[model samples]
Target: MPLPLYLLAVAVFAMGTSEFMLAGLLPDIAADLGVTVGSAGLLTSAFAAGMVVGAPLMAGLARNRPGRSSLAAFLLVFLAAHVLGAVTGSFPVLVASRVVAALSNAGFLAVALTTAVPLVPADRRGRALAVLLSGTTAAMVAGVPAGAALGTILGWRATFWAVVVLCLPAVVGILGGIPAQPAPRGPAGGPALRTELAQLRRVRLVLVMLLGALVNAATFGGLTFLAPVVTGTAGLDQWWVPAVLVIFGVGSFAGVSIAGRLSDRRPGLVLAVGGPALLIGWLALAVLAGEPVALLVLVFVQGLLSFALGGTLITRVLYEAAGAPTMAGSYATAALNVGAVVGPLIAAATLGVVAGHRGPLWAGAALVAVALLVALPCRQVFASRSGVPTGPAR
Candidate 1:
């Protein structure tokens, strides 16, 4: 990858770490904030809500702004949010900080996503996207686990401070790497804001994005309370949490890495194979919740299957949103965060009703089952159903 692309990845790494590290810190956050673990998990939803709204809103606001300036501005806001979050003792203040951080993260991601595409050839767009999103995968592999350790050794506040520090490199990278000029206007020399928002009305586009959301819902639902699952349900010690997370992250990185090679060429087949496999993995996880060894192994398997399916869904979403170049990344980002919002919310509710950590496992399985059904008319399904034209929606 080019140095500029790596620069973008560095920014993405910071954003992803800020977004996903919460999964590991929920317990500590809850204890410190005088809230339930489920309540602490709401911080994830808070961040997702900001991303859901901020991606498009901030992208639109910055559409005519210089890429380098807008990116730098976003990073500054992100850094400030983390500082405030780290210093505050109020849970509400922390929640508010998460929203602000998410807004910045969302804006940074939108610009980076659009900018990264133009830096690569048309045929290699998928590979380029993979490189950018690999920051996310790398966050899972390195950042989240490291943050968990920091929180464990110091406190959750230290993790927040760590994020503030981690973002410094991104700020410097954006300033030095992205070109200092506003995005070029459309071919007709007109802003495409109207055209961009109109793409939301396209049923095919919405449904494809829905597929992306449901898959994400499944992943985040299980992920939000994963620390508790590791220590509580699986009977593992608290210290084992980070190691288990590392195992899952290693699998997640590998899964997405493999998807990079396969998804662009055979998204349908990737979905066809990955969807069912992930669902089965979820079921096995719920059923095997009592076995510490099984839980550890299943977490790895689940991470692999989930991200492989997720990458394919995201690639398909971008394909469907091709008409909205400036907004394509926002739509994809929204789809992922939509899942993040709904997943933990529903999974948290399940915690009250279900017997143990199995609730999220069940919820994840059901969500993906719906995704599979929603995508029934997609390539392999319709082809299997006989003599139907190919499509990605119901």
Candidate 2:
């Protein structure tokens, strides 16, 4: 609802593009740097690893810093990493750049979410967060594809340069738009890492984090192998892959928009509905992959439930960890990345035993079923805490 939130979204867009564009540029980077394509693919893994490790580390490091200052610093470092990668053209340097960029990206996101939530009314935090996260969905829909096309035309280095350029406006926005908000303080009147860690230990918070991981694992496990499923199972032409992806992206955007509006008042309801909805979607995909029309429709529904569940889960975590906003946000990022890494491994293993393209779908469905079981008990947690809703102190 505020201008600063949009700026935060811009920051996420740049970071997300950097995270995903590597997928399209790996072949080019491998050829140019004289490395194997598989080696270049490691850059993506390195970025994910950085996000998983760096988020909590950076959050702790910046725990005492003002939100605006820390966010600006993170973006500057992110921009510098891209510039170095673009100019150096060395494979090792490029790999290092991705790690640095991912670290900074994690820091920016954790800080930005912490920053944005306090800027709005308590009831509006869900919408504010949704608006901020929509930037990533936008990146998936537009930024990655555009970067890929740009890499194809002007070379992959140029795409890095473009990311650098895209980051500049966000930096300026952080400086000019966001007011200085001091880091959150404990009851003792200073930032307390111990207190935050204690809050993180709560069973409610732990369950929420695990729930987030399961949701992501379910979605990405299948999504990672989407292209093959589209062609091999659905009997679609190669050209249909991108179109189907676009459809899924559109569904994701719609999901976020709907979930954002409802999460503030009915987060539990959203989760209850979305989690089961996702289970059904995955099960449908497992059975319907051979039917092209059914497969396409289910893919779109899966994307919708994936992101809708994601937003609701984040809202739940933020609520449950209301005592430690910064660390809570970092924990959320770490949980999601854990799923991102583990999901594909699970899918790959399932494919080894399962006979066809449906393995991923079956794997995803099983994960979602587990997530639903985990989610069922959470209603009591929310009920116990309902009297004192956790939100920013105005």
Candidate 3:
């Protein structure tokens, strides 16, 4: 991998840390702010909601600009938001900072993909993409857990402060490491947003994107708040929370690698397999919650499969939307944010009615079913174009 790609990865690492660290610190933030845990959770939702709104809007704004400059600028915006978040005293102000961070976060990922694609050869696109995106999983594994630990020891506010401290070095690293590659200019500059939106009308392509989003969102929606669910219902020790999260991160890391390799050859197979694997994992977790050993083993396996869909699905969407790849990435990002918002809300709601954390597992299973149904239409659509059945992309 090139130095530039690694710099991009650092930016991604920062985004991942900033985005996910909130969940681990939710309890702390709630207590300090003198609010309910639910209110603090809105911080997570606000960020996701920002991503949902920001991805397309920011990507569209940069349509005519150079991908390199846009990516760099977004990182600057992201850094500033974190700085504000750390310093802000009021809760509403903190949410406002999150919204700003959200815009930067969504824009960074969307543009990063767009920026990265042009740097590599066509046949090597999948591998290059895998390398760029791996940073996200790495953050899940390393950044979030570390932040959680920091919050536990120091203070939740200090965690945000720590993230802000990371940004200074990150900004410098990105500027130093990334080369001056000129922005890509299409034959007529860039296509109009209207033209890009029209590409969605291709029934098969749009369907696949939606299916990918549904699957991606369905898994994350529940999984994001798994810590709270487990802590509340399972009656686990507080120290165990970080350990459980670290286990999930380990699964995520392994899943990204496996998913990347498989997607390069067999995207459809990975997606098909991932959905069932995740469903089973959730089911196992629900049934075995009482048995500490069984629950841990099941959740680990579930975590591996739960996120296995990310790389494969992203590649699938990229290939399907080759006509307008950046827009496709944006659309996918929007689905991701939509899922982020919907997942926790669903889990919270399910818990409200049901007595145990089982509600989330059942809810996730239902979502996986929806993802599969959505994928059915998409499979037929992609089959005709690629002249490949529901096997591997290779």
Candidate 4:
């Protein structure tokens, strides 16, 4: 709840907006750049690819740097990339800009995750993560939709400009609000990268992050193809898509709120209850994509369960990775981006060829089912570590 945490959230909001708003701007981008819409869609893939590569690389490179300075530099690069993308007439240049922006976004997120945990009490680490991640959910509910609307009125370039403008205050806040000195568990004085990577071999940390990847694979895979399911399969009007997405967003926000309050105390309980419920929810969606009423109701419920599970896994990552302060954030960031890339590929492969509109739902269900299987024996792992360590890192 500190000002620094909120400032980090503000920066995350801008980055999250840039990440998801392209969903709505793709057609316009393709038209303006004289490329096929399918080609412009590659920009999204480029961003995810950048994130996957950047998260660990950037986090490792800046592991011992001043947090505030690192954050400011990342924000500056992100803003500059957006500016370049907005003005560029060449699609290749625009793609390059997206890649650059994604790298900046990944670095900021990797550092921010580690930065947030130390800003609060050990017991409140989950809450701190929620505060930072709320920016992402808020982007889904407001920023992405708003960007799409702006694109409608002012063109896609405006959305890029908006991201640049929005990030300016965050750069200032990083330079001012956040302290130059590291937090108690800060990575500034943490072990070398080799030693940090050793902590990743901790079985619990490995399992938790792997679970995070699978959970996100399910959710992101389903979400990436949801708009089509809504309009094409569920027989809804195009206008209804936004409303359905908003419902999901509202549920996602609620999920994160609940996780913030409960994850620190009852993460095991959440993982036990919510994880299976998420799998069931995805399975149900896979079976009922054609039923509009079912689709409408389930989307919100799915969002709630998926993200509740997500937050718990993230907390577990922090707790289990207690020995790896330097690389912990990158570990979490890479898992999510890995899922972001793999999920859609799984869903897209199933689309039309296998499950038609229901492919993504099936893909999601399969991923969660695998996650549950992975977690079944890992109950012992959760039993071992319950909260973030209050003492030194590991």
Candidate 5:
């Protein structure tokens, strides 16, 4: 609720837009570069790979420092990457710029969540994280739409330029808006990073984080291939694809907002309902490919239910980690990156090997089922600790 938090959200919004806008612009980038769209799609893969490596690398380097200034520096790095991406002439150079952007992107988010955790009271940690994570959803709702429109009119590179332009004022906002806060000191006696990593080794915590990863994989595995799935299989108009995605984005934002409220009361119940609903949504798409309206409805439902699990899993992991919030946040960011990478690879193998788009939907359903099993154990953990603390991870 603080001004600083809002500024942080704006930066996240920009980053989210830049990261996701590539999905809609793949064709444009491919056409301009004279490459296959699938090859151009490596921009997303490159970004995810960077995040997988960057989250820990950047967070570890920034550890034990005042995170505010470090976060600002990372944002500057993110801004520069986008600017270079806009101007780069060669495809490989553009890909490299995206990788740079991804590193900054992952680092910025990990740092932001670490800074954000201690900003509010302990009782509100789940809500705070939900608020922070909402920026990603808001990016889908607002940034993706805006970027897609810009790319359509001015070219894909122009959208990257637009993100670069936004980052300048965002930097100004960060300087003027956010309050200076020191890094978190460890509880009682300080623990070394090795101790912190050891604390996170608890099986329950690891399971919850892996569950989060699987849920993310399922959602994105199907989603990354969504536009093509609808156009090629559902026989929908190409121009209408972005509109469908916008609807899904709206659903995602709505789910994220609702999940925050639900986590406070019945985290387990939310997952129970959401997990099954997600399975149903995917099934509807697999069976109803010819019905575009039906498919879009399923997409909306899928987004709504798939993301409903996010807050619950994040809350559970932070709670389970107990004494390593920054490390936990860093690792949580890493788990998410793992999911992001897995989603695309899973989709690619299924669709590519099978030579059909339906593979992603089927594979996504199976992934969700695995998440569902993981959720059962999560429910038992929460149920047994009905009056447990839901404080920040540390």
Candidate 6:
């Protein structure tokens, strides 16, 4: 991949850290702002909601802008939002800042994905996306934990300040590293919103989007409540939670690395293997939640399957929606966040009816099973078009 792609990855890492760091800081934020912890949790939801709304909106608005310029602009907005968050004392202001930051983050990622793919050959697009998305996995492994530690030492505000500082290098990289590339246009030689929408109407493309949502829902549904599963069910010490999370994060990184290599040549096969693996992992977790050793091993495997499945789903979407790369990329962002939001809700609801921490695992298993079924038809599609040009579908 090109240096500009790595630069884009850096920006993604910074934004992803900001997105996930809030989970660790919620208690501190509640204490400082004199709000309930549940209320403070709304900040995470607000950020997700912003992403769901902003992805398509921002991509549409910037459809005619240069990709480099758009990325830089989004990063600037993100930086400003982090600054506002760090300095603000009012709870509403903090929430607003999160929404603004998420909007910018979503816009940056959509534009960045669109920009990064064209920088390499068509066959390498899957690997290129993996390089960009590895930033998010890196954030999970290093950035979120580091931000939490910083928040513990210097207060929650300091975490946001740290994010602001992190943004500087990404900004410089975006400005200096990326060359100006004209925004993509339709065959008629202009930005075609109608054409993009029409491209999204295809059955295969819609199925890929649905698959993305379902797989993410499965992953997050179980993961959102993983701390409880570790401490409550597995009988591990609270401190062990971090270690388990680190294992999962490392596994995620590994999974993405492997998936990137295979997705170009065998995307459908990756999905076929990964989706069922995820289902089995979740089922195993549900059945063996009481065994710490089993729980630990399953979590790592689950993380691997989750991310590998993610890479496959995204590659499929990009292939199916090649006619509308920018819009398709934006929609992928929105779909994933939509799943992120819904997954936790489903898991939370199941917790009341199902026994113990097994609830989330069972819920996740069901979601992944559905996703596997949905992905069945796409195998032939991928096999038939292995090296074919993924231009706009006729």
TM-score of each: 0.94, 0.86, 0.91, 0.91, 0.92, 0.90
Please report the TM-score between candidate 3 and the true structure: 0.91
98 in model 4: Cα distance from truth in Å?
2.4
lDDT of 1: 0.82
Per-residue lDDT tens digits for candidate 2, residues 261-356, read: 877777767777887888989998899899999988897888788998887777777777777765777888878877776776677666656546
Candidate 4 residues 95-174, lDDT tens each? 89989998998999988888887678888988998999898888878887788678877988999999988998888888
Candidate 2 clashing pairs, residues 3+ apart or interchain: none
Instruction: Report the Cα RMSD per candidate.
Output: 4.3, 3.3, 3.8, 2.8, 2.5, 3.0
Candidate ranking under TM-score, highest first, comes to 1, 5, 3, 4, 6, 2
RMSD of 4: 2.8
lDDT of each: 0.82, 0.78, 0.71, 0.81, 0.75, 0.79
Better of 1 and 5 by lDDT: 1
Q: Compared with the true structure, what per-residue lDDT tens digits does model 1 show for residues 1-394?
A: 6677889888888888889999889999999889999899899999999998899988888777667888899999999999999999999999999999989888888877777766765545567777888888888888988999999999989988888888998899878876676455444533378987898998777877888899999999998889888888888888888887788888888778767777667676778788899999999999997799898899899888888888766666666666677777788888888998999998998998845678988999999999999888755421221111111110
TM-score of 2: 0.86
Candidate 1 residues lying further than 4 Å off, grouped into runs, are: 186-191, 380-394
Please give, for residues 135-186, the per-residue lDDT of candidate 5 as tens digits: 7788777777778777877888889888888788878887777776555444
Candidate 6 Cα errors over 4 Å, as ranges: 23-42, 89-92, 182-191, 354-357, 386-394
Q: Pick the TM-score winner.
A: 1
Q: Can you list the residue pairs that collide in candidate 4? A: none
For every model shown, the clashing-pair count is 0, 0, 1, 0, 1, 0
